[model samples]
Target: MTRITVLGGTGYAGRNIVRVAAERGHTVTAYSRNEPASPVEGVEYRTGDVQDPEVIRAAVTGTDVVVSAVSPRGELEGTGKLRGIERRVAEEAARAGVRFGVVGGAGSLFVSEGGPRVADTPEFPDAIKPEAAELAAVLEDLQSSAAELDWFYVSPAGGFGEWAPGEATGTYRTGGDVLLVDESGESQISGADFADAVVSEIEHSEHRRERFTVAY
Candidate 1:
């Protein structure tokens, strides 16, 4: 089984990933600022300030894949803290020969070819723009990383988040760069399904050193 560690294990996206990975029998570890109130069984939970370099190093050292599900929000919003943490984790993962994965935002995805990004659209919320920008920067950093560093960034559909939390259908569509949408023009995916997609990537090693999106 693949050994996986999620840096923001208690967050919305990170917790789902941890649950799914553990259910799949993978050795999973979740490192977060605080311990989860309802921790997943068979998963190890680690608490620490991600700003510490030693914590990042320890989280990346032995895992086969290290996923960063942290987002820029709360105290981290507008601080550019998530980007810095992700960059350091990426560096540590590379040094340790572990695959790096980032759970990114849909803001960076193109609404159409060679055009404005989702975050750039007039209808997008201004408050979320900063978070999206930081996540986009994380993707850029991964793209420019060394060739030996295997990494993948995943941007979920536009309607993703705790507000929706759609049920897993065990099915979803995947795309690159462009945002995936249904015929109704709705772009969304369940947290469970998104976690499934991530674990599938971990097991299959598809889309190496690239970014991919998920939607219904």
Candidate 2:
């Protein structure tokens, strides 16, 4: 079983990933600013401020894979806090020879081949632009990272979030830089299924040092 650690283990995406990884028999560690309200069994829970370099180093010290499910919102919104944390994690993971994975926003994905990004669309909300931009910057940092750094960034569908938590279907479609959408033109994926796809990648090691999207 792989030893996996999630940096924002209490958040929506992180919690689902922690649950799925533990259920799959991996030794999982959930690290966040606060302990989870409902902790998962067989998983270690760690509470610490990710702003501390030591905390980031500790999180990546021994894990085979380190995933950052942190979002650029709240105190982190527009502050580049999440981006710095991701960079630190990436550096630590690289030094320790651990695979790095980031759960990014859909705003960075291209709407079509050789076209505008989702964040550039007029329909995208102005309020969320800051958060999206920060995430997009995180992706850019990963892309320019050293070749030895094994990393992957995942952008979920446009409709993803706690506001509309979809159910798990044990199925999902994956794509490259372009965003994936359903036949109805709806871009969405269940939180559980998205977590499944992340763990599946962790197990299979596909899409290395690149970005991928998930949808129904």
Off by over 4 Å in 2: none
lDDT of 2 by residue, 113-176 (tens): 9999999999999998988899999999999999999999999999988998889899999999
TM-score of each: 0.98, 0.98
Compose the digit string of candidate 1's lDDT tens values, residues 94-115: 8889999999999999999998
Instruction: Give the lDDT of residue 177 in candidate 2.
Output: 90
Candidate 1 stretches greater than 4 Å from native: none
Deviation of model 1 at 37, angstroms: 1.4
Clashes of each: 0, 0
Model 1 compared with the native: what TM-score? 0.98
